[model samples]
Target: MTDPTPPRPGSRAGRKASGAARRRTASTGARIREEGAPRVRLPRRLAPRKSPTQDRARETVEAILEAAVDLFSSRGYARTSTNHIARRAGVSVGSLYQYFPNKDAVLTALLARHLAAVESAIHACIPPLRDPAVPLRDGIRRLLELLREVHEADPRLSRAIEQQVGQMPVVPEGLAGYKRDHVATLAEILSTRPDVRPGNHALMAVLLAAVTETVSVVLVHAAPARFGRDEMLDEAVEALCRFVERPPGRLS
Candidate 1:
């Protein structure tokens, strides 16, 4: 058989293919720049798209939110004002009102953004629950690892969400319930283990959250010099495993 002719680069057909590939690459890069470049990487609102006029209106709405987080997290919510958020964000009061109805709405959105961030971080790292040992220390470690990863990734946001914002009144509190829900899940997993009983899940949940948050506070934030976060997280997971696996008679 005759040898195949060598393919010619820069030929008409080759150039057309190369040009198409270059366009695809450029368009993909642009999409990535837009999608990947998030402000604070927070989730956007679910509201419908605005008309061109409304789009100009949205700049002020964004400013209001940005200012609300800064002021509310810095000054007390009671001290911050809609007018203040407007001025600080560099938009007019009327412009701010175009999106947000009141200060509470602003606070709620910010808190939601915070929660959405932490939760998204957690969800992204969580693998599928397929293994039988998932209810055991293996599963517990996954959660602890996830918790630590989130805390270590954004220690400030963690502190702000768990403690600072929880204390604020401008936003209606969902945090207590949020913690309780996590506790409940932990309790459920603990209950499935041989040593832990179904009755103790509630208590275990409290313990789990307490240990995780305490370690996060002390090791990661309060006294970084004295303790290590990775060490604390590993130890906390071990302690929780003991709580679920240790027999009732082995109680200290």
Candidate 2:
């Protein structure tokens, strides 16, 4: 009878099988490590290729941005392509690429421009808010009005840009800084106000900023016909004032 035993380790068949098993083990180990490892997402290149230095270059960039805004607002960002933006701008695709790296970069530029204008308006309005003569509710109402005006100036564009930002993995440059400045400024102003109840001024400022922004966005983009802007604004002002101006030891 034949030997009822497998090949020895030194034999050719045994060595071949051993090598195949080793390779399988290695492949499985590698797959496990790959599966267990966290994925690293590189930041997107949202910045423009370069700033426009000449009037002609500036005009070309502006045209591309304007075209992108129109397309993004009308067709939506998912439907709008770089080629469409170039054609609408009446510039070559190459020219558009010379300034903006992609449509996202173009949108970033537009958002930055819009934010800068809004920041300027907010800064201008802050002085009035800081005045002792300005009632707390009145000051809050004015800030809300300013936000409404800026958002209403171009509601479609504002909504489109905001929706895209919500989907983005990263905030555009300058946006975080703007928020920090906004919160810091508001906190400082709140701390100085005699009527504002003493607590965490920074936290109050953050809440106020959030409420105003949310109300303004909703009113501009998605408010129902029954919810008039003025009525909503009044309600918001009353609610915020109650929160920030409640007397000490008052639970309500």
Candidate 3:
């Protein structure tokens, strides 16, 4: 008997059969790996799979982000799933994947949004700070007020973002870069102020950024009752000013 005619290289039936085989192989391999190894969930696919420039796409992304924030803040990261996020956002899972590769990427996007908002506020406050006439203490208090507004805006969401920082690689880098920019700006401003003697302005800037961020997060996230908002702000302003405003030759 003649052998059955071979399926053409580009035949639809052949392609379908090949795809089925691949799916089975992938399924088996995934099962074996799942059974053989412990799952380590680091923040992979930290970038979006697709960036939505259209207004409709942007709205979808916003909905997804808001849903993620609510779920992450209420349920915690470990418990929230991409499927849940898609459902909450009222988008299909396929639509969710069109923008984000996974839940971690969603979290990354949310953190990025938060960072942008905070940085915008800080930048807007800088022109006033840069005025040589503005008292250093006044500039600092204004800065402290701006930061408090950001941190206290959604304390639960801020805490949720902090909890995922170590696991997600991009968060720390983003935050560090933000602090570095602020430090450089603060140092330049200090350099122009005759009333201030920021000994090693670079070092003082770093310390000031660190102290302010830590104090703001702690006061807004965990210790609002333990420490009053104004009280914490006053203490932070005092500490930062003391570090930057040395008595001309205090270091010497």
Candidate whose lDDT is highest: 2
By TM-score, the best candidate is 2
Give per-candidate clash totals: 0, 0, 0
lDDT of candidate 3? 0.68
Misplaced by over 4 Å in model 3 are 1-45, 51-57, 170-176, 226-228, 247-252
lDDT of 2 by residue, 117-186 (tens): 5676687779888997888778777877788788888889988987888776677445646778888999
RMSD of 1: 15.5
Spell out the clash pairs found in candidate 2.
none
lDDT of 2: 0.72
Alpha-carbon deviation at 23 in model 3, angstroms: 36
- Which runs in model 2 stand beyond 4 Å of their true positions? 1-44, 51-56, 224-228, 247-252
Q: CA lDDT of 62 in candidate 2?
A: 63
> CA lDDT of each candidate?
0.54, 0.72, 0.68
